[model samples]
Target: MVSAVLLAAGQARRMGQPKQLLPLDGKPMVWQVASAACGADLLEVVAVTGAAGEDVGLALADLPLRIIHNENWSNGQASTIRLAVQSLDTRAKAVLFLLADQPLVNKALINNLVKAYRESGASLVVPRWQNQRGNPTLFDLSRWRTELLQLTGDQGARGILAAHPQCIHYVDLPGPEILLDVDTPEEYWQMQQLWQQYKVTKG
Candidate 1:
């Protein structure tokens, strides 16, 4: 089974608000990402919440998500990632880690990453659109679960990917807008502008 674990616990210190709760196309940003992940019809989709845990959970409550609350959210990104990895089903052969801020992530992009991992058997399946590399990266559980669980503070398995280039596979992402991560107020505004353009094209 291949599962998706979304990291939604960020403090968004720059944005001065929970980016997960930020509205995108009338729904919370996290909801958009979660919906896409679930819609991909993968084995499972888990959302790890920190910061505004209850609010985030409530926002995603209607969706079919396995929500996990990270008490050590203040620790940094790695904390939530490790927590999510711990909560995965033992049967999961691969896990995709998604950025909560990437609301542009859609079912098609997610399925592409998962499908590539399944057929390519790459240790890591990353998305690339032109020159941009984006998130919702997939990792073969057998290859990186140990290292993932070993992540400390804000550390992630990207270091391992950097160390071993031979095992990484790059899948062509259908859209470059999926690379937008709303870390600042300016980016959020940019996302809002891009959203309009993206939907019209998507439709």
Candidate 2:
């Protein structure tokens, strides 16, 4: 079974507040992301929280997902990734990593990646937009579990990707949602503006 790990353990230092709790279309950023993950074709969804663990939990209280707190969140993203990966069920075949700040990643993108992974037999599945890779990358745990467990510091699977480029199967996708991430207050505001514009365009 494929499992998803939503990383929401960041301190959000640039935003001066927990970006996970910030409102996006009236829902907390993490909640929106988790909701999208829940809508995907996955066996389980796990949300990793840190500094704002309590509020993140509250925001996702209604969701049927597991919440895991990372005590080493200050050590950077790798720690949270390790925590999520280690906590995965033994039955899990592959795992998809999602970021809490990338609220635009919807169910379709995730399901598409899963479909590609199942059909291509690739150890790594990533989305590419205009030749640029994007987040919510899926890794076959049967191949990379040991390497992922040994990961340290903030690089967070980057070193693994660099070392195993041949294992990747990039899914060509449209739009910048694959790369759009909210890191600061200004970026969050910009995301809202862009979301509004997108809504108008879609309508």
Candidate 3:
């Protein structure tokens, strides 16, 4: 069975606050990401939190997910990833690595990745948009647990995936949403406007 790990332990030093708590479409940003994960056809979902763990926890209180606190979160994002990887239940054969900041990624995107994982048998599955890889990657547990624990720097899992490109499978998505990440106030504001436009079109 496949599982999911939502990474939300960053200090958000650039944004000056926890971006996970940043509001988007009437709820915390991380809540939207977590909600999407909950909608996936997976065996388990765990949200790894640090820094402002309690506040983020409250934001995701209603989601059906296991909240795992990363005490070594100050070390970096990789530390939180290690914590989550270690917390997986025995039933999880693989894990989808998700980022809390990518609120635009929906359940359909995650389900698409899961479907690809079950079909490809690749050691790592990463989403690609216009030929660029994106977040919410999936790693086959049997292949990368050792390398995952050894990850220490700020860059999350890219180095390992790069070193083993033969094992990495990419899912081609249609939009730039896969490349958009809310790191600055301007970007966040732009996303809000875009979301408003999308809503109007749907309405």
In candidate 2, how many Å is residue 69 off?
0.7
Q: lDDT of all predictions, in order shown?
A: 0.88, 0.90, 0.87
Evaluated with lDDT, which candidate comes out highest?
2
TM-score of decoy 3: 0.95
Q: Candidate 1 on 57-122: residue-level lDDT in tens?
A: 999999988999999999988888889888998889999998889988899888888888878878
In angstroms, give how far residue 83 of model 2 lies from its true place. 1.2
Candidate 2 on 29-119: residue-level lDDT in tens? 8998999999999989999999889899899999989999998999988999899999998899999999999888888899999999999
Model 1, C-alpha of 2: deviation from truth (Å): 0.8
Better of 1 and 3 by TM-score: 1
lDDT of 2 at 67: 95
TM-score of each: 0.96, 0.96, 0.95
Model 2, stretches more than 4 Å misplaced? 200-203
- Separate clash counts for every candidate: 0, 0, 0
Q: Following a full C-alpha superposition, what root-mean-square deviation does model 1 have from the true structure?
A: 1.2
